[model samples]
Target: MDKVFNAITTSGEEGVFQTELCKSFSLDSRDGSRLVGNLEKQSLITREKALYNGRWTYKLVVKKSIPVDAIEQKPIDLSSVEGAPCICCPSQHLCSIEDESNPISPAKCQIIEEWVTISFNKFMMIQQTEII
Candidate 1:
């Protein structure tokens, strides 16, 4: 399942065809289909019907990434919004003027307001800290 998920994620938004997945994992059609069905049921991936090499098949796309690491990590403070745009935007690939989907450019994004406010607050905090 991990290998299958990896392959689909590696393909990115383009997704991986069921036939290709079966071939790569040396899995029979039934097994591959079953695995894909399970993953889809879990909302981990979506299997969309697509044309592959003039044949009909499903393209498996990752809906979300599951963190595999077990290491304990510090929680990031939400009050500090540094690098928020890059961290939050899902349509970075379509950010250019040529892309019609980009209704708000990064320079004009309302989402960045929180980030700017947080940054200003941090800067003020540093100034106060140094003055003391």
Candidate 2:
């Protein structure tokens, strides 16, 4: 991290400073120009671009903001007892069954098949916690 910081701020009296990416990281163009763009195609550095002093240089592109990705979900058939009856009705049916003995009416457990997926965003926020 220190090396990265140094490379980013590697400025001399001539005012020319640059650093090749040591590792894949989120770009912080506070000062100096870090090369960007696909190096294979051509140089991505803009001499006039900067987050502060009008100079940002880098070879690899570091996208700061990231969009979230939606999660996928699939529906499945629910397991049900064909002849299970609701407490209220003697005949087998799919409904709530209330207990008469207890003042609190508890319904008979039912088979509920649900499907859900978790969505995640590829956000790169500042680290809030440090692992000691």
Candidate 3:
């Protein structure tokens, strides 16, 4: 979705972006997924993992049809906002990943994979699998 939205807004009627272009940032394709949304929700046409040239890219549409700046935003104080983490408008409510308010800071993300999912097969260990 992020890719599609970027393709449209960044390129225009051509509406295209290559994931390889992301290499400049050194982003790993399998590290995580990107979503383009107004308030933390993606809408309109979306694409995912479309490898055109040894790269993965997701294409999606923007609901408002506006371009959002990908540059790092200055961290803000989340405590001031009632629903800090739940804020849809980062400009108004959410703080930058650098802000202490951010449970996961941008700096933290850069140093490590902030969102690493580890799967352990408890069934294979000492626990039995149960149907919930």
Please give, for residues 1-132, the per-residue lDDT of candidate 2 as tens digits.
444433433432222223334333444543322333222134312233324236454332322223444434565654333323333444334332454554332242332221111111111122323322
Question: Judged by TM-score, which candidate is best?
Answer: 1
lDDT of 1 by residue, 7-95 (tens): 88899988899999999999999999999999899998998999999999998898965576855688888755547775658776656
TM-score of each: 0.48, 0.15, 0.27
List the candidate numbers ranked by TM-score, top first: 1, 3, 2
Which regions of candidate 3 fall more than 4 Å away from where they truly are?
1-8, 35-40, 48-51, 54-57, 60-132
lDDT of 3 by residue, 68-129 (tens): 58655787865333332333434334335556767555444432331221113333343454
Q: Going through the candidates in order, what is the number of backbone clashes in each?
A: 0, 9, 5
Candidate 3 worst ten-residue window by lDDT: 110-119
> Which regions of candidate 2 deviate over 4 angstroms?
1-35, 39-48, 51-61, 64-132
Off by over 4 Å in 1: 65-132
Per-model C-alpha lDDT, please?
A: 0.84, 0.32, 0.42
Residue 85 alpha-carbon offset, candidate 2, angstroms: 56
Q: Cα deviation in Å at residue 32, candidate 2?
A: 13
